[model samples]
Target chain A: MSANKSILVCRCAERGLVDTDGIAGGESVLVIPDLCRAVADGDPMLGGAFSEVHACHPRAVQSLFRFAGHPLPDTTQVIDCRCDGAGHAALGTMEDKPPAWYPVIDYDRCSSCGQCLEFCLFGVYEKAPDGRIRVVNPDQCKNNCPACARICPEAAIIFPKSVEVPINGAEIDDEAAVRANIRVNVDEILGDDVYAALRARKQKRKALLNRKKIERALEERRKCSGGDQ
Target chain B: MKMEKTGVHGIPSTLQERDSLRLRVETYADQQGLVPPLSMEELRDHALELAPSSVSVDYVMVLLNNAVWRETVASIPYERRLLLLPQCLRDFKNCPAEMDEFGLLCEECGRCNIGELQSLAEDLGYVVLVAEGSTVVTRLLDGGKVDAVIGVSCLNALEKSFPHMADGAIPGLAIPLNAGGCIDTTTDVEHVRNAIRLRSDASWVNQVDTARIREMVEGWFSAIEIDSMDTRTEQIAYEWVCGEGKRWRPYLLACTYDALSGADGIFPEKVRRLALAVECFHKASLIHDDIEDDDEVRYNAPTLHCQYGIPVALNAGDFLVGEGYRLIASVPSRTADLMRIAVENHRMLCVGQGEELRGLVDTPPFTAAQLIEIFRRKTAPAFGAALRLGALAAGGDDRLDAALRRFSESLGIAYQIHDDLEEYRSGEEHDLRASILLALANDQRPLEWYAPDSPNLDHVFREMMVEEKAAQLLEHYKNEAIRALNPLASAPLKSLLRRTTSKMLTPAGGRA
Candidate 1:
């Protein structure tokens, strides 16, 4: 848990994965946004969703590098420009493959509800305090850009087709430009509606709050049930 | 009886018999497991004590004449009707007068109200439509999908809908707009909550199917908890007042939604679950009532305290309250909010208990008006909430919620008065004998009754008969009950309810 220890280690704990390689004495360890991909690409015990993410993790994480997976995740899937401030960023061309890193965003349409945050396991966007979303570390994104735009209540958030916006008045790589336009995380951009729904649903379930505690006991009972076998 | 180890497939069949036998044996606990049925006089005496007035007696008889209400309910296939009350109109907050204005007529503001109603429609759960006007109603019903309706409206919409509501042979309950025409108005919040509760019925057929209840009770005998002291307490509680009670509160809700949607047949799971919950509440209240009254017998069996100790019995009631609510809250999250209201209503029951207790000696000279207020606070909320929650569970229109509130309030007062008259006549005390009605009624009579109790007060019983003036005092209270019901708009259900109310309005000697 040292400052020098990568955040990936922290995220690994959050995602319920057991970390066997405990920062062994001064060994050089490459940082990657996702262990799911690192495990799936080279290691065993993961498949399907990983097969899809192996293609898109690298290009988005411009600052940090992930050695385990492919070069970059399809940035086209992480569409909202607000997440990346200066619109679509380019990461050169993967010729004969239609440059899988097309960036998309439609700002006027987004109601900014953070269902995408819950949907994304890869911590692609970080929610800011002022109710806007920012994508500070896109390198953590593991290809399956689910947090980008799957289901929005108001149909407010959407992916913009690969369009290029000028960043710093220079036409850079579309994935890079997309990366530079990092104003907020998708959740902060669409925070209110999800917050309201969560609040309402919570209030209604208040009487059963004790049941939640009971559920812990029930869980213990369930575990014991397996032990009985 | 030899315990049979039935196979899994055969478990359900035997479970039913087992539960039925369990109920029976529990009833006969005092007879050492040979409970003889109460004689006709015993039933009449109990019935009369419970329902002395003509109205109450008739209501009981109607319930007793199970053939009638059941046939009436059965013949009417479940139907649903939806009256999109003004609350559905998002802009309903705009105008002061245009809201669910205690008057009928709704100004549709075009919002999520219609969307919610549409989803209900698509579920094929019921026959539902946005009722913007009276003319549209006929066409809506002409499709013949709805047998009843849950309406949302001010008094104005109700005025327009009532004729169509009646024209369609539909049983409908209105969910009125909150106090102001607004959906989120503070005054309307409780009104909306109550109305939804009243309109929603446990739809016993839908969720907690008979198959499941049988399943849960299955293997229960062999289960670890069956013979425990707690189980015995529940058994004793269930034995008393376990016969022929219509889950009117829960069913009213299911019926309201079905009426609007033109759905047929009660969802077996819904009503079964609702019945379980409602009956638990009813049982819990009775346990406490018996404790307060100091009665030892009910339904011709020893009361909870008589069978189990008082402390255990009280805990048993609380356990049921908790269990009943959990059963309700355990439902899907979609209807979780409605279940929460069911739990909150238990607080209102406590309020009624407190009022009843405080009234025992607080000689504030009870008036008919005051008693009516007490009954409204104590009883109407439960009855009204029962019907509303069912409709809400089905996601009925917000408009009819208000109208249903008024309807339940009226019906509740009528029932309370009928109860007072019955108690006045039966003079049968099982427990909690320091009756509020008895005391209040006696208060209104001439002081001469307080004079040395003539022949009636002789013997050790003379002190008990000190309140002979109760019969005369009940007469005035009955009028107050009628007045309470006068405000709501008319419909067949209202008339039936009124008839049920009047049936219990007889003189102490079965003479109307």
Candidate 2:
């Protein structure tokens, strides 16, 4: 069934932002282990199989589907269960492996280019014996640093929790989206030194940002004031 | 159903992917003959084929649209472009900015990326707006306040705003926030920085440094005496030429010429003659005005008539007038036109002074309309001639000439009022000059109040609202001057005129 045809609930097994205990369970209601993780992991249950979503927030849940390559139809209503008397969700199962915050490869888009493997400073990816690149240490990936993903040649890497779309797994839909999102060519700015460049970006953003205003003001004063005279 | 896959929603995930996709999209757009403003459908088809299957049509469409518009957007002067940023980009938890009807008033606190981006765009001359939604965008575009936009928003919001861009085909580039929740949204800040820095090969954007131009014009007057300061009259004329006046008339002439000249912005030698002629006409009028008004002080020195007596001062003034004609007649091009301007302006000025000398034997010492007419006739012609001569040298078109005429008229009247307000404080005695306040006072005062020592002078002036009326006229004329420049197409000349207005009338903020 398409997502719009049934009600969906995420009994978030861990964070418990929502609880499914009192929800009416019927053919019209569909329950999920966790929408965020299900979307992140490419779980088949997230397919167009529900009409309504009982999630933390409509916008957050809607984005979760976008990351999973299946956007929620406009016809579906997302019911927020994060507040009110919605008690802590109990999934009645053991907590699985700690939530992964690593890059997920979109195999359909990956051209086996090995760009990610070469770009990773940490052992996030490795050359499999079959001569294919694989995520060897997903846990080792840096948190909130999607630098490696930005350097992807085919935009095939997904950081499900990232702040920007495409990287966060939302589809690019319009010119505005395209203009806002640019895959930067690291070679152009830092001379192909991805490792050093990535490391320096953090520090430089601070250092360079400090001087930008001062430099611009001096330049503007000269231009506007018509020079020292 | 096909095997489930996470993360292949179509936008570029990695910078490398994005970079490569952009190049491919450019090539594809060219091959497909896809012009900019290729509607969403056209972009979709090409995007699907050109971008990686994993990437969405919208991702590739950005490349395609930018490929076509990149040159156009870059070519627009930064002064004409608008930078539209969403307020949600702020760190709502820590942001201290306030929102007005127009948009967020950024505090530049550095708590969020908006501050850095705003500073960068503003430095390049963009009008920046940090707001939510497309309302401000529509208003700005409709009002012709901007030519292009660099906008950032979330996908959900983009859905609403993108239609405006696509429909108008208004040249713009958009960046969507990575995840959607109005709070704590993120984007590639570096990407934004690059977009703001984009420029075209227009050489003039970097030209016309105001101070450099001011210094150059000042240098021209400082460098010479009239071949021979042989006679006493010659010496006085040269001395008056180098007096402590601001040299604004000549500066206006040179700046106008520069604005309309070649992109290299060279100050041609011939312009010196034309500028000096302008100064001559100005000095000659000041000399004669001092004789008529019997002024004792000018440029912080004794009036020419006071120092040299009316006989010699009158002769010296005639000599400067002759010199003005001589200088204009010497310039090779537009000699006839320049001479006509000088003579016509000189005539209007004499007529205005003639009215002043005849006396305001009317109901109020002088009617406000009659005073304004006197100011317009006396002050506006000199400024008009200066600007017109400069423009004529540039081979300016009829529209430019008309604009210059309108601009100079308002500028002249406004400037005269400013001077009057400065010289005549409220409740002060009216000098021999035609003062707006005197006219205003006459409008309210009883005939007996005209007595020299009328005790209620200050009270009558206050009750009449003389100061406020004069200030309003000054402000009204200043705005009129600005409005006159709107019809002008030359960006440099418009900018120069605007800067000139600000320099003169900004103090007319006559809180007086």
Question: Which candidate number maximizes TM-score?
Answer: 2
Q: What is the CAPRI rating of model 1's predicted complex? A: incorrect
lDDT of 2 by residue, A62-103 (tens): 655765668777887878665422577444323554453567
Which tens-of-lDDT digit does each residue in B1-512 have in candidate 2? 01112232456667687668677766776676544444455556666677666766665666676775566578778876777788767876677665533446676889899989987987777767775434434434432223577877655555555544543445677765655444566777887888889887854342345567778878887887656667777888878887778888888888888877843446776688888888988898888989887789998889888988999888888998899888888888877877877788889988987887775443336767778888888888878988888888888877888888888889989998888887665334455236777676766653422554556656776788888988898988977887787666565566567656756754433221
Docking class of 2: incorrect
Worst 10 residues of 1 chain B by lDDT: B98-107
Per-model TM-score, in order, reads 0.33, 0.49
lDDT tens per residue, model 1, B1-512: 11122222211133354245324323333233211122122223433544423223322321222211122223333333233444333433243222110122222223334434434432433333333233334334322234444555543334444433332333444443323222321113333333233333334221112223234322221242333545665655444324334444444444444433334434545544654576667777778888987889876877777778799788877877775776677666455666756756677667766776776556543454566666666777666666566556556545444555565566566566556556544755432223444345344452223322233432323344433434444444444434333332222333333333444444445311
- Which ranges of candidate 2 are over 4 A from the true structure? A1-229, B1-89, B94-112, B115-195, B263-265, B360-364, B422-433, B441-455, B508-512
Q: Which candidate is the best by DockQ?
A: 2
- lDDT of each model, Cα atoms only? 0.41, 0.68
Model 1 residue A106 CA deviation (Å) reads: 98
